[model samples]
Target: MSNPIMMYTEGLHTIPLEREGIRYFVSSNSENCKNGLKLHVEVQPKDSPSRALPNTQNVVAAEPTSPSGSAHYGHSVILSILLCVIVVLAY
Candidate 1:
């Protein structure tokens, strides 16, 4: 029997399907497994032909105007440092 490639859902899982040619596994019902759910998986064999993504760069929004769009890298760094200081003080 051929071993199927595994993928994780909300937890660790091992698929029993094999990768040969263009194969797809889709599940819309949950009445067979212990997880009470199913997944849709697609597999392409290593030798299968596929389209390649172009190397050209796509335009992205450089200037963020909304609060959700703003990057908060500095805030995360400050929070990390604060946590480290608190941990050290507690020791």
Candidate 2:
């Protein structure tokens, strides 16, 4: 309600949390963490989504893929197919 708490030591990000209690550290470099944003995501009474995660074991995160240096897929697939056809015909 007052201000968002610092969770991660790096990056400018905001996360909302509410619990029975929590603990945190205050330091000079970590001061910017205090300025992170806050959002309230509370479960409503008789909510269903809370049943999904208990031990949090049922969730798996898909890692973000780094972009390949070239536009590897969009054009190369067509070009390779055409080249293969040309090679077969020339033979």
Candidate 3:
């Protein structure tokens, strides 16, 4: 189960949770969250079996845009490779 409350931005969402007077913020998106950590979750206490501990995970905000917008370097490299292959095949 996940938290129902979330603050959504253009490419990310932030989920806030509080435990033992401490606040934790977890930032994630559909792309990064698939292979990475979850939004916000509670940790189990090792000392106390009856108490649930808070896992404080801070997610750094990523730069949503580059100089070329959402285009990545790998995409350009792949396109260049394809163009080279096409030219060589045509010759």
Candidate 4:
């Protein structure tokens, strides 16, 4: 399968992803993502609308919580994989 095209922009961005039999998208803003070290992940069904309507209740802020040791490790691994993906795709 071909990978999706991703454009690197200055503000909030959303990327669609599918795993196993599940479909979702992840949205993140570099400026608001802990200096690009973290992501503001949002998941929705494939049938749902990708863009949130203004003043709609579809958008919900994620609850803030401290990451455990394992969570930190997972985040690091994810970051590494993301970096590798970017490098490979850029070529």
**Per-candidate TM vs. native?**
0.23, 0.24, 0.32, 0.23
For candidate 1, write residues 12-67 as lDDT tens digits. Answer: 44655575544444333334444444444566555423555557587888896676
Task: Output candidate 3 Cα RMSD.
Answer: 8.9
Error of 3 at 29 (Å): 6.8
Candidate closer to the true structure by TM-score (higher is better), 2 or 4:
2
Per-prediction backbone clash count: 1, 0, 0, 0
Candidate 1 wrong stretches, greater than 4 Å: 1-71
Which pairs clash in the backbone of model 4? Answer: none
| lDDT, candidate 2, 30-62, per-residue tens | 445467533334443443875665656557889
On a 0 to 100 scale, what is the lDDT of residue 18 in model 3? 34
lDDT of 4 by residue, 1-91 (tens): 1252454647665554553343423334444544445333445455546564566566788999876779758978999999999999999
Error of 2 at 30 (Å): 28
lDDT for position 11 in model 3? 67
Ranked candidates (TM-score, high to low):
3, 2, 4, 1
